[model samples]
Target: MTQQPTPDAPTVLLVDDEAALADSLALWLERRYRVRVAYSGREALQTFDESVDLVFLDHNLPGLSGESVLEELSRRVDPSSFAVVMLSAAPGDELADLPVDAVLTKPVTKRDVFDAADRFVGDAPEAKLD
Candidate 1:
């Protein structure tokens, strides 16, 4: 039997205080998925809409912490509407209880980014409904 393709491309929100890094990662991910970038957690929550499919958040940010952003996102969107992944240079237990899909350490590769994105967006056939 032939498999049905996904209805829409996954939309990723990449939040980092480093503008260059965020830009580069957004550029790289844009080739394969719809990508959005924010320099801080506050900016991320402000820029966020209901269309996001995945979120790659840096733990340390200027205005708000990544954990705060995750909390805001969790409140605003349904659990299945998007997957939140924390990306940090310093990985710790603080993120363990956060409502997130995954926690990825920094110095992340292109392959790793893509793999994580795929894991969040690829498996769910009904991800777009919400």
Candidate 2:
């Protein structure tokens, strides 16, 4: 099972074949949102659920490509319910055929992740600095 989200914070699923990257993103993201890390497409499919408010999908995975996973997700639920951001080195226009809220280029930075979170799910309560 994925990490359970607390009542207040939104859940974020980070799917990437790169273990280091996924872990790094999860570590930083956990300060705000409830974070789940899936190292493969199969794991991502399993980890995702209704609770997820945002998904950061890496396009070029070793097994089930992000496009395929997105297709399956689209079939399982309404696309508009949760936000999907496809991460890829390819140009955004090339991915126009894909159903995604936004396309972020790799190598994504902490700022990119934070921006996406804010844009999609709004700020997590803990993200605010007094």
Clashing pairs in 2: none
Judging by lDDT against the true structure, name the best candidate: 2
**TM-scores, all models, native as reference:** 0.84, 0.89
Top-TM-score structure, candidate number: 2
User: Per-residue lDDT for 38-77 in model 2, tens only?
Assistant: 9888899999998888999999998899999888888888
lDDT of each: 0.81, 0.87
Q: lDDT score, residue 124, model 1?
A: 34
Candidate 2 matches the true fold with a TM-score of 0.89
lDDT value for candidate 2?
A: 0.87
Q: After superposition, how far is residue 19 of candidate 1 from its true place, in Å?
A: 1.1
Off by over 4 Å in 2: 1-6, 127-130
